[model samples]
Each structure stands twice: as structure tokens, then as C-alpha cells.
Target: MEQASSNHTLQAEIDALKASLQQTNSQLEEAQYRLEEANDMIEAIRSGEVDALVVKGEDGHQLYTLKSSNLAYRIFVEQMTTGAATLNRQGTILYCNSRFASILELPLEKVAGSVFCDLAVASEISNCNELMNAAWVHSGLKRELNLITSSGKEVPVLLSLQAMQLEEGLFMSVIVTDLTDQKKQQQLLKEKNIALQEAQETARELNANLEQTVRERTKELYSNQERLSRILETMAEGVEIIDTNGHLTYANLMAQKILGITQSETDDHVYIDPKWQAFHVNGSPLPENEHPMAIAMTSGKSVYDFEIGMQAPDRERFYISINAAPIRDEQGTIIGSIGTFTDVTHRRKSIQQKDDFISVASHELRTPIATLKASLQLLGRMKENPDPVMLHRLIDQSNKSLNKVSVLVNDLLDTKKMSEGQLQLNKTCFSVAVLVNDCCQHIRATGNYEITYEGDKDIMVEADMDKIDQVLVNLVNNAVKYAAASKQIKVRVVREGKFAKINVVDGGPGIPQDRLSNLFERYYRVDTKDNHYSGLGLGLYISAEIIQKHGGKIGVESKLGEGSTFWFTIPLA
Candidate 1:
């Protein structure tokens, strides 16, 4: 039995030894597996796959970050513009970049230990927690929320949460984007849109009123046109409008009168109508293209002060000064031409008369000057050995020449005085008959003609005696010079009403009827049959002025073959 028990104990011991060996084998296997795991972790750390390791220490759990990942990753996380942070499972901040710390208005060290939810806005704490739970389940989740800063101000942020499972612990990475500037931009855009809508409404209102404004303007334009039409009708100058086709579309009253066209005939009238004869100032034919209106239309330029002559049917030729301008559209295209014309007939006639007077005055002055020069030369030659009769003849010739010059000079002076309205008259009571007789005394002494006085001899008048004598002398002289064929001149004075009428009758060739009207005009002279009259044309004009100054009238009566009578009347005493 001792042997068996010992054997059994040995067998039990063997069994125990087997069990021990099995446990040792299991322990060895586990040691080998752990060794493999450690090697793998070391490999992972070396390869920079593991960032940190969690170790249980005497105090608490601690994180030991591997230096293998080094400064590069830390620099990348810290330099991010978006707030970058790592959080623990309990929402406690483990690592935070400067940007993340700046968002919470806290230092980087302070942010690292702080609970992330504590910084969240009180109203959004639940939402943030929900987002965090969702992020833990889904790995990557995005949410928008507000966080309270260190100063208790709310800051809007967009959070991108990404949960990571590590061998040590569960961690979350958060990317925060600031939304304050973006919200401000959205609000500003909304304001601009509202302003644009208001402006569009104002524009619609202006468009609605545009038609009414246009209608009012049209009415005002019509009223102005009517007023302009009335003004055109009353204007002294002629106004005519021509169409592009060169037909007269409109003509004012003065235009029709000047052009000698009736209103009915205006429809057929053109600027270059054949019936309307146009001439230049020099009496040359004016071509159609040279007309003022034609030039204005063709060249689109104004023609001012263009003097043109036209002869209407059964009317005398007349001059007209034309001012023409082209009518244009808004785009400056020539539409037609408008011309204003003024009748310049009297001005033209005066210019011609002035030219003629210059020629005549020069001729008349030369003759007396030559005669006086010759008489003086003769008197000088006979001075050495003087024959009394020859000397007396020369003296008489000089005196007569001087008297002629004096008369010519006096006439020029009197004409200038009358033109300027500076003629001074000395009035006295004088007998008209006596003045006529005395005026004829010199002619009677010459015995060149027989002078007779008729009518009332005692006719008296209030007049400038010298001026009256001058008028009478001029008439008697003209009778003597012009009526040399008939040697009789009758001077008559008569009283009719409150005036005395004097007449100087002659048997000269009567002036033509056509020339009678202008006889009293300045520089007008009657064309005698002989055309040998030596006096200036100013005699009749001066005589008329003198009689007019005495408040009298002067006129002439003549028949083709019945001689001529010149007469004047002044107020009687």
C-alpha cells in the first residue's frame, strides 16, 4: 500500500507537473503574443502611425505623445486658419491650436484642459452634445453652432467633427470655421436687393407720366407756332419756306407782296420759277444755283446780306437783301432752307444817285476852275502893258467865274445843312411880288429874256427873304437856261386863302412824265432835250427845302407841248 500511494502521489505529481507545464506553455505563448504586439506598436511608432499612447500611472491616465510624428504635424495643426482641436470622449479639449484658443478668447494652455461644452453657448449646449454624439457614431459629422467666448460674447462657428479610434482612447478632431463675416455679407446683399426694388418702382412711375408730359409739350408747341405765324404775317421783312423739292410751301404776307405772287399762285411757285426774273447787283443774270436759298440748302450753310434783284411782271425791277439759313433736323441733316428778304429798292436807287452825283459834281467844278485859271492867266499877262478895255474884259470874266464858283459852293453847303436838319431861317414880313421883281432885275438887265410880273403885286408873306429870293432866282435862271428858245418869263404872285402863291412860268421843253415825281429829290435833274444844262441837280431840291422851311408848298405843272410853270406858296402876312 505504501508503494501504491507513493506511486499515486507521483502520478498526481506528474499530473500536476503536466498541468503546470500546460500553464507555463500557455504563459509562454501569451508572452510571445505580447512580444509580437509590442514589436508591432514599436513599428507603428517608428513609422509615425501612432501619435500618442495612453498609460495608467500612479495618479491617473496620462497621454504620452510619440516624438516620431515630431514638430511637422504640430506645426501643421497650429498654423491652420480654421480652428483645429482634438477633444476627449467627454468633450474635454486635449489639444488645441492657437486658432482654436483665439476663437474661445482663451490661452492655448487654458483651452487644452477645458471642457468644450462649457464654452458652447448655453442655448446651443444640447445641440452641440447631440452633434458630438452623432460625430462619435458616424466618424465625420458637420454642424453649426454658437460658442461663448471668454468675454461672454457669442461667436458663430461652423464645426466639422471627425471622431478617431486609437489604440489608447477615443478622440475627436474638430475644424471650426468663423461665420460672422459671411453672415454680414448675406445681410448686406439683402439690403441692396431691397434698394434695387425701390428704384425699379420709381422708374415705373416716371414711365407712366412720360406720355402726359409729351402731350403737354405738344400743346405748348402748337400754341407757340400760332403765335409765330401771327408774328410772321405782321413782319415787314418777307419770310418764305421752301420744301426739299424746292417748291414754296409757305409764304408770309410780305413775302407774297414782295414776290408779286398771290396766295393761290404760291402752290405753283418754285425758288427758280421761270416767271420770276432774278439778277445780280451788277444787273447780270443770277443762275438758279447762285440763289441764296439754293446755296443755303445745297451747302447747308447760311447766306447773309446777299443782295439780289428781281423783276416782277408789270412791275419795276427791285433789289432785295436776303438772309437765308438751312433748316436742319435733330441729327443735323439739311431739311430745307428759310430765307428772310427785305426790299432794298430805295437803298439801291440812293446808291446809284450818289455815284451819278459824284461824276456830275466833278465835271461842274472842273469847268469853272479852268475858266477862272484862264482868266487869271490872262490878267497876269496883260499886267505889264495893260490895255484898259482888255483889262476890263478880263476883270469882268474873272468876276463872273468867281460868282459861278460861289453859287456852286453855296449850293453844296446848303445841301449839307438841309440834310443834317441844321438850316437856320430868319423870318421877316416881305412882299412876295417885290422879291420876284428884284430877283428878275439881274436877268432883265442882261436882256437875255423878257420878264413879266403878273397876279397880285401887293402879295405879302412871312418868310426868310434871302432864301425866298434864292428860290425865285433859281427858277428864273432855270427858265433862262432851259427855255432859251422862248424869250418870255412871267413871274406872278397871288393871294389865295392864308398864303401867297408865286409862279415862274417858262416855255421850256416840258419834263417827261416819268421823271416828274423825282424832280424834287436830292441830286435829281430834269433831262432837257438839249442835255446842255450846266447847273447842279441840287437846285430844285434846295428850292423845295427852302419853301418847306417857310411852311409852304412847291410844285410844277407841265404838258408835253404846253411849256412849264414852277410855283411855290408861303403863309401870307
Candidate 2:
């Protein structure tokens, strides 16, 4: 019995040992399964498949939690105007935003699985791959590349890449910016620069040719002394010869006409005669010693390009550019001097106009460009964490600046067309009243001024409708600008015989009488100390040209203290 009991005890011990072993093995399997589940959860979180993670404590209560940022990141990607995408280490697209798909003109699903390098042009594919490789070492890379769109059109883009290490694998985030508009602007600036260089070269060549011509003519005069009289008579420029004693020896017919001199006065020393009174370019009385002929004779040196205003015998004041050189006889003794005069009143006026145009254009373009630059800089700073309202305001401001730039460009083009006598007119029959009201609507909406209209509602005219509208808008805008304090503007349309008359009347400080006649001149602006007004000063000039082309007229009436009225008359249709 004792042996049997000992055997049973041994068996019971073995069975207990086996049961403990089986329990331990089952616990091990469960632990392994839980570990696998935990790893899967981590992977799901990394892949953005899981949004939240919960941990339970010994009390079966949550101890720690983690939330995914995938939603916020996706929203940010969607909001970006620039294209964004993610690619694998091998340059295969793994993810992409709507903007990226739009740029390629393909569906997002199609783009996500496609090779990024394949989307680039054949010539750019190698470079694209190289750029991707460089991104791994440099952390980021940027390049300009041409991408082939779905339609097979090559589009230029600025591509930027940044390497990212994720739980799943390594990836590269790419940002693509369309370079179409930027390229266009760059091309325009380049063309302008080239044109400017060409113009400068042409001006230099003209000056050189002019100087050479003058030198050649001087040599010819000395070599062919016998034919001097005949040469002087046939020359286009006015020529005169004066002795060293200041007595006039000879004067060509052209010289007589230019100086408004009689046949008898041709023999007199006009330089020393007070009756010939001349003024400096600044309108100061010119001294006899400072005259080109007087200076050349007394100093025995050439005087070139001395511009002065002269009171002709007809009492009319005109500008002349004079060049004089001392003449020497065979013995090398100073004998006399020869002088030539070129009428330069028109040329001086043209130069002044050109200078004014450049000044005005620079000022006009600078303001909008500065505004645009500032807006863009501010927008860039706020892009990462932007307030929706403020972002909208910034965008609106930028749009306004762009519009101003567009308007300035259009005005410049129109001015160029006017200069080339190529300003086209597209005419149509339109009601004058409707046109005037439509033009003023935008200005009136600003609530800065009270606009009043009085006219025959049925008055119709045949003219370039858009051009007329532009003129009307310009007039109203000026009225509002100058009469802001007065706060009132009146527009009137009336029928006078065979013409329809339109007037823009403003209640403001009236223009001076001296400035009235020059109102329609190109680049002419009223002198003002106030900095509120700015423009290229081409509006009135363009308006006048448009009216004249339609066989009409434009004018302004003003009194210093009262008010002003700008009016135009177009032939009735």
C-alpha cells in the first residue's frame, strides 16, 4: 500500500508540472499576439490609418493618449495654391494634393501611383531624377523644370523637394509652383532692357554722325574758300561771316530770314547791335561777349551747341542752336569767324515732353509696384498661420495693385499707339446719356462724391464706344480727385446743331488761365503742392486725340475762384 501511495504522489506531481508548463506556454502565445497587435497599432498610426491611441492602466482606466495630425496636415495641403506631393525614395508618387493633380491635368489617383520623373519632359527626366537624389544629401533641393501635362503640353514649374523619414519608408515632399506668369514678366523686362540699350546705341550713333558731319563741313569750307558764298546760299542752316573787328562781312539769304534782317542790315555787325537782342536759354539777357560768334572771334576757339532765344526783327521770339568757329588766313592769323544757326524750338519742346513722360511714368509705376511688393511680403509671412479675414484683405490689396499696374501698362501702350498715329477707333452707335451714367457708376459707388447728371436721354452718337467710355471715366475720376473737398460733380449732355456736347463739371479750386491751354498737352499736369494726386498725365491728351479722330473737339473752361468744366463735342449719329 505504501509503494502504491508513493507512486500516486509522483504521478500527481508530474501531472501538476505538465499543467503548469501548458499554462506558461499559453501565456507566452497570448503575450506574443498582444505584442503583434501593438506593433500593428503603431504602424496604423504612422500610416494615418488610426487617429487616436488609448492605453489602459492596472485599474482599467485610460492612462495616456495620442492623436494623429493627419487631418490638419491634409487641410493645409489642400489650401495651398502651390502644388504639393509626396514621393517614395525611388521617385514614385505616394501621395498628392488637388493642386498637384490640377497642374498635371490628371486625376489625383492617377498621379499618386505614377512615377514623378515620367511626368517631366524627356529632356528634363534625367535632371528630375538627379534633383531627387540630391535632395537626400542636401535635405532639400530646388530647380526649375518643364513638366509634360496630360495634354502633352510642356509647362514650366519651380520644383522644390525635401527628404522625409517616416515609419513606413523614406519619402520626399515636393512643392511645385507654376512659372508661367513669372516667366512672362521676366521676358517682358528683358525685352524692355534690350530696347532701352538699342535706343541708347542709336542716340550715340546719331550724335557721332552729327559731330562728324560738322567736322567735314568745316574742312570743306576751308578747302573750297572760293565756293564759300555759293555753299552758304545752298545750305539749309543759316550762315554768317563776321570780321575780327565785329563787322559783318557777309550773310546768306537763310541767315537774313532767320535773323529777320533786311538786306541792308546784312552788312552790319548784328552781334554788337543791341537791336538784335538775344536771351540765354533761361530767358536772361545774353551779353554780346557771350554770343557764339563773339566768343569764337575773341577767344580764337570753336563754340558748339550754344542755344539761345532771339527776338527777330518781326518781334517774334524763337530758339536757335548756334555753332561758331574762328577762321584763320594762310598766314595762320585770326581773320574772322563763321557761325551757323539751327532752329531748335520744336526740338527743345520735344525733349522737355520726353523728360516729363519719363518722370511721370516712373512715379506712376513705382507706387503700385511698391504696394504689390509689400502686400506679397506680408502675405508670405502670414501663410503658415494665416487668419482667414486678414489673408483675404491682403489678397484684395494685392489685386488692386495688380489692377493699377495693368491700367498703367494699357495707358503706356495707348500713348505709344498715339505717337505712331495708329490709335485705332472701333465705332458704334450708343446713347450718350447711358454711356455717361455707366462711366460714373463705379466712381459714385465709392461714396466720395455726389454725382449729378443732366442731359437729353435720347441723344445718340456714333463713336468708338469703349474709347468714349474711357474718356468719360477719366473726366469723372479727375473731377472726383480734384473736387474731393467740394464733394460734388455734374455731368451734362446737350445737343448743339449737328453735334452732341458732353461736359464734366466740378466744384473745386479752378485751374489758372495759363494752365488751361496746356491741359490737353501730353505729360502736362497742374502744379500742386498737395501729394494726393498722381498720374502719367496722358488721360486728357488721349481724350483729345480720340475726339479729334471722330471729327470732334475737346476743351476746358476755368476761373481761379469759381469752378471748372471739361467738355467734348462729338458729331451726332
Candidate 3:
């Protein structure tokens, strides 16, 4: 029993020993947990996420310290490092990044602690303070400088700076950048600016010259247009403008009158032969494909002397001569045509009358005048002295024959003067009474004609005296020549307010009213081809010109069977 009891108690003691050991182990584990907690707290504080930090002297005295920066805390730095670096305001490095140490070709131990200016500053600058202070004051500054490396090599560098507050003092973060490539770029840019300015100035000069050229060309064009306009307006021929569609765009004064319309009342177009309702001179309508102007426009050619008659609806017609040409644009495309027209009606009629007059004049006067001239020449050839009365009678007959010759000669000369517009007058102040007396004396010398004169020598006026005398002589001579059967010829001069008038009265076959309008026209005669007259029909026209030059007027008042009174007026001096 004692042995068994001893074994049980031993077992109990063993058990109790084991339980106590277990308790001791539990306490030890608790203490170890506490130690681990403290280590974790220290690690958390060292991470720089918190403002609190711990630092001490080697002798255990506290030294200068700083709280975590708000920027550093915001960045959540799990690792901390202090490297040799500098930054400009833009965060660009002046010295270098932490990676600079490897490129320095030096032991990293010294490289990490070196100031960036010591390696990268240009050699010309002894101190970096001048550049750094300026950056600090302005917050942003950059300067180029020369610096010497530790090995005595000179380098060009750009020093860019910014201000930073650090543990030691206020410092400007200067960034050192190499300027070798930048110097070359600046030189190239300067050269480019110089070339650009030169090009711009050259362009300005060219623009000024071009402007002057344009102005001069415009002036030349204006002058040409003016000359062309004057020629078109003043030419005796009529000119008209038309578009490609054959519409009249413009016309001169003569054209409007020829077409029988006022300027404003004219239509957009007028046909060359307006009598045709649809088609006239051209294909479908006037100025269509076959028309002269249309052909010129389509072919780019000029056509001259196209005949277009101006006969309206009536048979009473007139002739027109035409010249037409095409107008083209810059690209040589046909735009329109210009047509010039000249009326040839009066010319054609006058030519026909001239032919008839020559034939009639040759037949009528040649027989009578030729016979008289032959007889006179025969009488002169035979040198025979006859009785005074017989010689006087023969002389009188010769004088009559000579007078007939003089009439024919005077008619020829008068026609030549009037047609040439060369009949001149000695226009001067003269006594009209003297001119009248001389004319009267010549009329009295013709014993076959009876004369009557009125008005006295007191009448004075300004006139071409000789021309006025010619006019009076022609009138009186025409009366006697046309009416040798008349009983008497009356000449009279009367004064009206500011003027004087003269009249020559004779009994002769008067003119018809219808022929009176063109009575004074050249080559026109009252007697037709069958009943030929003695004169060339130029006497009356010549008389009219003389009176007109003397600033006088002439006309005839006649009844076909009764008589005619030729009258004239002269302005008083």
C-alpha cells in the first residue's frame, strides 16, 4: 500500500510541476508580444508618415529635428533617402537626380554628398550665390555660367534656380544643365530670323511695284476707251453695239435717228431688214446664223460693205453700206459684234442726176454757142474795115455771143466753187447802195431788158460787196434769160428794223412747191432731160452761198404762171 501511495504522490507532484511550467511559459509569451508591439510602433514612426520622430545625440542629448513635411506625408513614403540633388522651380534638376552618382565616374560615397554646382556649373562663375539669390528673390531664374570641374576642365552650363527651405538654411535649388547643343541652336535661330526679315522686306518692295504697274495699265485703258468713244460718237457713219444674242446694247445719236426712234424708245434689237416678221437678213431672224454680224461673230472675222436697205414697209427706200466685226474676250471667245452703217441714198440719187445733167447740157448749149463762136472767129480773121454803123451792128451781135459764152463759163465756175466749199468772200463793211447801183448799171447796159429800182444811197450795211453784187447780177440775169418775153424787171431795197432787204421781180415760169425744197441743190434743174436748160443749174446755189457768207438770206416767192420775186436780206453794220 505504501509503495503505491508513493507512486501516485510522485505522479501528482510531476503533474503539478508541469502545470507551473505551463503558466511560466504563458507569461513569457505575453512579454514577448509586448516587445514586438513596441518594435512595430518604432517602425511606424520611422516611416515619415507621422509627424513625430525620434533623434538623439550619441551622448543621449536631443538635437535639432523636424516634423514630417505635409508634402512628404501626402506622398506616403515607405522609404527615405537624402541624395545630393538640386531642383529648379519646374522640378527639373540643376545638379542631378539620385541616378547622377553612377554617371559621375567616382565613388558613390563622395558623389552622393557633393553639391551639384561643384560638378555642373560653368567655369567662369566662381560662386553660385549670385545666380541662386536671384532665383530666390524672383522664384524663377536661369543663367548660363562657366565652371571648372574637380579635374580642372571648363564646361558651359545653364543654371536654373528656385527657392527651398531646408534644415540648414534657406537655399535656392539651382539646376545645372549643359549648354553645348543649345548654343548651336540659338545661333541657327538668329540666322533664320535675319533671312526671314530680308525676304519680308523684298516682298514689300515687290508689292509696291506691282501696285504702280496696275495703276499705269488702268490709266492707259481709260485713255483708250475715251478715244474710242469720241471716234464712235463723232464719225459720220452710224455705229451700234450688239451682244452675242444679237440684242442692241448701245447706239450712237446717228444710229438712233436712222432707225427712226428716240434713244430711250429703241428696242433691245433692230433688224437689218425690219419688214420681215420672223426672218429677214439672217436665217430665222435678223442677226441669225447667216447675217453678216452673226457670221463675223461665229467665225471671228470681219465683213465689209454688206448692203442693207432701209425701206420700211413702203417702197420708198434708201440704201445703207455696212461694215461689221466680231468682238472677243480674253480667252478668244466671241462675245458680240459691232456694226457700222453709212447712208448712201442721197449719194446714189445725186450721181444719177449728175449723169443725166451731163448728157442734157452737152446737147442743149453746144449748137447755139458753137455757131456764135465760129461766126465771131470768122469775122475776126478777115481784117476788113467796114462802115461804122455796120461794124457797130456786128460788134453788138458778137457781144451777145460773148455774153452767152460767159453765162456757160460762169455756171461751170460756180458749180466748182459750191461743191468744193471753197467759194470765198471779202467780208467787210460796205455800202449796199453802191452794190445796188452797179448791178443796176449792168442791167441797163442790156438794152433788151427793162429795169425798175427803188430805195436811195442812204442805206448802209455790212456785206461781202462783190459776192452781193454777184448775187444781184445772177438774179437779174436769170430773170432776163428765162423770161426774155417779159415787159420789165423790178429791183428794190427796203430797210426793216436792224436789217435791209432787196427784191428782184420778173415775169417767168415759177417753181412747183414740191421741187422748191431741193431747188437750190447742186445739179438740180426745173427742166427735165427732154426740155434742157442753158445753165448747169449751179447759179442759184452759188447765189445762196454768197448771201450766206455775207450773213444774209435768199429765197423766191413765185406763182407758177404769174411771176417770181427773188429776195435777199443783209445785216446792217
Candidate 4:
């Protein structure tokens, strides 16, 4: 009976174990089905179906993500909690990561659709429409724009504006970051810089006080200052002071005169010394930047006498012998630069005129002396000529040529007197028309060439009779000399409103094209064979000066093959 009861108990125990096993299998099957559903959902979302995966949390009835592997979506969602911004198409506010909204003192909801400009950001893209239009027209562009928040605060943001051809038309993605805190910190630091500046100011004040006391204690200041000030103001040379910033601090009378700048004009003004003062032959700014005497003081390089020239609008080209030295206090620290300059322009001009006179005198004297010598030789060779009349004619021609030489010499002497301010024009009312006819008649008498005249009627002008005669003679002689080989030399005088125009036209070879511009410059001779073979080329220059002195203009017009005309105009009485 005991064995039977034991077997019954064992059977009951086995039956209970089987029931527990079945329950475990059922739970396992349910778990497998749920996992398969989750996998299916993830696959669907990834295969162009949805944006995310949903799952249940560890606690009962709590929801969570079973799997989230979409990095772009993850970043987009995370941006709502971060300061980084994730933008969508059309530049709409897609997502401001939490950190970003915090930077702007705004909520995510308030910032949505705020756009970049709604915030008070002063960015380069204040004109976003123009930029977007350009981008769409061109396809892709990247630029930086400042961001504004709902709180009317501005923040610097680097924006990458991109265009993509999406299935839903054009799309752009803007990635932004806030630099407000950084800028604020920088501003705060910049404000704090006053301490450093004040310290420097204090140091400067202390040094200045110390220098004042030291100079006074030494008892040499009054004497030195008096000497310096007197020398600066009364020195024979001009003087100027330029602060380290290249500002005009002080200018002496001579300096003002040389540069044509008065104290009134240059007071407290930023002065830029002409560039020629700094450049050398090799196109380098002399003494370098640190060598601009004021600069040399800071850099410890010595500067010596420097020569410079400046051209003014008044046609005053001033040449200055310059000396620049560092201006220092008693402590010997460079404060600025003091430059001494003298007006050497007049001196230079005088020297040049002297040189020009010598050159012209020598050149003019050479040919006449040569002709006289040649004539003497020829006359000597013909001393025993068979024809007395022919010999007499030769002597007469030689004498006439000699008379011309003497006249030119006299004219040179007169020019010297005029340059020395001794010659004066005897102003009178004379008829330019009469003078023109006289010149025509004279040219005709001397030369067998056809010389025609126009406007022979008396048209009076205000000029010295001799000066008018001189002008006409020079022009007619030049015409005769140049047109000796031509068929006709025409002199035309016309009365225009308030001025009378005189023209000497020659059908001979016109001036060379290149020689027309410099016809008035002294000693400027054309390289043409005909020009070289003619009388000295002083006629035009002398005529030009005389005409200009009379308030008239002289010019020439000619082409390569066309005949040339020399013309002048004078004011009518």
C-alpha cells in the first residue's frame, strides 16, 4: 500500500512541472512576436515609409523608442535641445536646438518661423532676398548672416545657404551657431581696456611732470627754448613740425611760402608730404617707414639732410633743402619731428635761366660767326674778280647778312634787359592790320617768293608799336625762311569779336608732327633736315613769349603732308 501512495505523489509533482513549462513557452512565443513586429516597423520606416521607430519602455504602460538609427532625424531632434539650428527648405525656422534658443532667451515655439531677420541680428545678409534670388538663379551659394531672436537681440551666426534640387522643388538647409556670448565677452574685455589705457596715461603724466621739474631744476630750459623758438621762427630757412601722426603742428613763414600753404590753411590739419619726398631712384620710400625722421626716433635710426621738391597749383615748383630731426623733450624721448626747409625754387629758376641764356647765346652765335667767316673767305677769294658789279653784289649780300646778325645780337641784349626787369612795353593804340601789311611788304621786298596778305584795313589793337612790329617781323621772317622753297607764303589777319587773329601759312614742308608741341620751348629744335638748314629756331619761342606777355596764345596746326600755319591772337582795343 505504501509504494502505491508514493507513486501517486510523484505523478502529481510531474504534472505540476509540465504546467509551469507550458506557461514559460507561451510567454516566449509572445515575446518573439513582439520583437518581429518591432523589426518590421523599423524596416518600414527605413524603406521610405516613416521617420522613426516607436517602442515601449521598461515600466509598464510607458512608451519609448525601440530603435532610432536615423542620424539626420536624431540630430534634428537633438538640435531642439542644443544651441545648433537645423533649418528646412524656404529658410523657415525648422528646429533650434535647446541650447540655441537659450542663447537667444527664447523658447523653441516662439522662435519657429521667426526667420533670420526677425531677430535684431546685424548680419551681412540683411538683404536675404537679393541673395536668395541670386542663389536660385545660380543654384548654390554659401554665406554668413547674423541671426536675430524673438527678444530683439542680435547674435552672430555663420549660415551656409545651400540650394538642392529636391523632388519637392528647390530646398535649402541652413546650419547655424550662436556667437553672441563670445562677442559679448569680447566687448566686455574691450571695455576693460580702459584700465590699461589709464595706466599708460598715468605713466605719461608722471613722465611729463618729472621732465618739467628736471628741466626747470637744470636751469637751462628758458635759454634753450628761447633759442629753439627763435631759430624756428626767424631762421633763414623754412621750418615745419610734423607730429608722429603726420599732422602739421607748426610751420614757419618760409615753409608756408615754399609749399604755398599759409598757417590758416594748414592749422591742425593732417598733412601728407608729397610722395616724391619719400621716393628714391629705385621706387622705394626713402628712410623706409621707420626712417621718416619721426619714425626714426622710435626705431633709433639717424636721419640726415634730405632734399625734396613739391609742385603747387600756382605753377610754383618749390625745391627745398630739407633737414629733419627728431623733436624730443629733456628726457631725450622722441615726441615728433621738426623739419627745416628753404625756398630754393627761385634760386633754381635763376640758375636755369642763366644756363639757358648761355646755351642759346652760344648756339645762335655759332652760325652767324660761321657765315661771316665764310663770307670773308669768299670775298677774299674773289678780290680780283673780272666782274666788278658781281663782286659788289656779293659784298652787298654779305653786308646785309651781317646786318641781320647784328640785329639778332641786339635782340639778345634786349631779352637780357627784359629778364632783368628793366625792359618795358610802350603800350599804345596801333593797327595790327597796318603792321601785317608792313610785314607783307617787307617780306616781298627781301624775298622773290609770293607773299600774299589779307585784312589790310586798319583794325586797331592795344599794344606797343615796336613790340607789334617785332612780333610781325619774327612771324614773317619764320614764314619766309621756312617757305623759301614753297610757291606762296600767305599772311592772314582777321578781326574776331574782341581779338584779332593773325596766321602765317606756308605751303612748304609743314613742321614734323612730333615737333609741334615743343615749338615754344627754348632751344627745342626739330630734327628735320630743313629745320636744321634754316635760321636758328628761336623765332617761335621768342614770338610765343612776347605774345603771352601780351595776353595772347600762339599755336600751330599741321599734318604730315598738309601745309602748316603759325597763328597768334591778340586782344582788340
Clashes of each: 0, 0, 8, 11
lDDT of 1 by residue, 510-539 (tens): 767787788898888776565757877999
Model 3: weakest 10-residue lDDT segment is 73-82
* Per-residue lDDT over 270-385 for candidate 3, one digit per residue giving the tens place of the 0 to 100 score: 54434533233222334446666777678767666565545555345566656666665545566677666767666456556767778767865686577677757766765585
lDDT of 1 at 564: 85
The TM-score ranking, best first, is 1, 2, 3, 4
TM-score for each model? 0.58, 0.54, 0.42, 0.40
| Reference-based lDDT, residue 351, model 4 | 52
> Which pairs clash in the backbone of model 2?
none
Task: Select the stronger candidate by TM-score from 2 and 3.
Answer: 2
Under the 3 Å rule for N, CA and C atoms, how many clashes does model 4 have?
11
Which number leads on lDDT?
A: 1
Q: How high is the CA lDDT of each candidate model?
A: 0.76, 0.74, 0.60, 0.58
Q: Is candidate 1 or candidate 2 better by TM-score?
A: 1
Q: Which ten residues in a row have the lowest lDDT in candidate 1?
A: 209-218
Error of 4 at 497 (Å): 4.8
- Displacement of the residue 367 alpha carbon in candidate 1, Å: 1.2
C-alpha root-mean-square deviation, each candidate: 38.6, 33.3, 38.8, 28.6
Model 1 residue 476 lDDT? Answer: 87
TM-score of 2: 0.54
Better of 3 and 4 by TM-score: 3
Candidate 4, position 406, lDDT: 85
